[model samples]
Target chain A: MPTSNCSTRSASGLALRAVADTLPLCIAVIPWGILTGALAIQIGMSPLQAQLMSLLVFAGAAQLSGMTLIASAAPLGAIFASTFVISSRHLLYSVVFRQHVTQLSRSLKVIMAFILTDEMFAVSEAHTKRSGQFSALFALVSGFSFYVIWNVATLIGILIGDTFKDLDSLGLDFAIAATFIAMTFGELRRFPVFIAVLASGCLSVLLKPIFTDSYIVIAALAGMLAAYVLGQEGET
Target chain B: MWWAITGMALITFFNRYAFFADFVRYSPGAKVKRFLSYSSYAVLTAIWAPIVFSVDTQTGFTHAGADYLIGVSVAAALSLLRVPSIVVVLTSAAVFFGIRFVI
Candidate 1:
């Protein structure tokens, strides 16, 4: 149990170690953050508002989609709906966290909940899954690293928006598509999961016109439900 | 807009807190765990399937679009080949524009 605790290391040491583990991801997020900030402006947020959004509401998917919706002058409700849908993944992350971070204080949990982004979720998930325990400080600093870098990158993006503007147009955003595709395939080692992917794909394409981004939530639930059923059948 | 931002932030936080709260003694079974684990994949695909194949960003279902498709395929192949993600991102962008220039 002593070994399981990260208190063996200093708090900053543990945090930095976690940060080091997450460095590669943090690097990948730099350009992504810059693009978000710059895109926020291009889509019509003032520099101050864009920066504030990064400061206050820090989810990448929500900001990106919210920006697009704002550009289209979508109703306030639609913007909120899409932001909620895009960020539905957080619910899973929170559930996953409960398994490892059960001992964290209430205030810590609330604060930790505030900075839950995809990158942070990935890092924390890997750590918790590996050790069967979690370091609250480690999670905090890792989240902080992302939080600081994200805001800094965003400001840089705003200041240099003109120069980097061309980079986005070059289809540089393809990386996101490719990255997610790769990650999805990595998780599809099981046959049932492949079926889930196919089902989700079909359902999303079909539901695109109707539910839009909300289809993602629906498709995810549907596939997971399918996997659950298949797994149950196997058990029997 | 500020109200909406606050609303979104609150909703996002609550979505996150929904599970981590102590009051909820929720533990998912193996079946549900399998399902929850795949949520990310399912959602990611759901969001991007349209983007990768769609010709136009706005109306993605209209027709065949090669530029992004080609770029994504190349990047996905490289990723499967075990290349780093940063490289995958840059390479895909280059390949996308390259194909466009050629066309």
Candidate 2:
């Protein structure tokens, strides 16, 4: 009974921390989710479909990629391949998370995997790395919070899509671009990051004609390699 | 719609589940960790660059209104000033929209 009580208390404590950690991420995700919903509708998705995509895939990049492929009438296999390539980063996330979250049960790991977006993974990994605390409950809380906000935002965007046809005309898409730019610049304080960015951009441009849909993956791999090499050289 | 949605969800789940089941047995090395740190940067920049440089209607690249150039400038300026992220986002959006309106 004492062990049971201790476990329960620890689980709740972790859940509380996860919720706290996810609050800021949810705020950012809301706008992106809404934007995605509006775009989905603009591109002819019904509200139900948009919300369902959000619920199931729970990945902004993959959803956008899938929608783009559908709009372009790409083959079903191509759509799946492209999304899988684009989302391969999640593999990296799982590898890193495994280091800290090894104690979690299989059921908990599966559920957490369902909700692990780039942002959630980043925040949770950082939290655990900094504090050396691995709480499956916290991860679940954060994941669920993000999931709720993302779907709700998608629903809101779908509802408002008709009312806001000028969203793109108003340059709302620039928000995503701006966010990326800000994030990049924030990392430019380091030389390895700068090199990685330059390498990826150049490689992607060069490979675009050859790889077409898979350019991003190639570019990312090239960038990661370049950064890794540079970091090793510096340390040596 | 249902078919497409379900198919995509299944693929996503498979992609995620494979990592957890297969790769979680060992910790990533220092090299892997270093590489992962900049993974998002590469992916995000790859996505952002085309949007920034490609013209809306044209196939070729042109700065034109330079919407991204201006928006990035505002963001940098705001960061330097230590303005809040909300402020930076709103300011950049306003700048982009205002430019679109005038030019």
Model 1, B17-89: lDDT tens digits are 8988888999888656666766666666766676555333676455335888787788768766766555666
- Where is the poorest 10-residue window by lDDT in model 1 chain A? A227-236
* lDDT for each candidate structure: 0.72, 0.72
- Put down candidate 2 lDDT per residue, A78-151, tens digits, no spaces: 88888787777677667666665566678877888898876676556545655776656666777898899999
Q: Estimate, for each residue in B21-88, the C-alpha lDDT of model 2 and write its tens digit.
A: 74545667876777887776676666656555543344644542577678768976774565544566
The sequence of per-residue lDDT tens digits that candidate 1 reaches over residues A118-161 is 66765665566567767777788889888998899889878766
Clashing pairs in 1: none
Clashing pairs in 2: none
Q: Assess the local accuracy of residue A92 in candidate 1 as a C-alpha lDDT between 0 and 100.
A: 80
Residue A102 in model 2: lDDT: 63
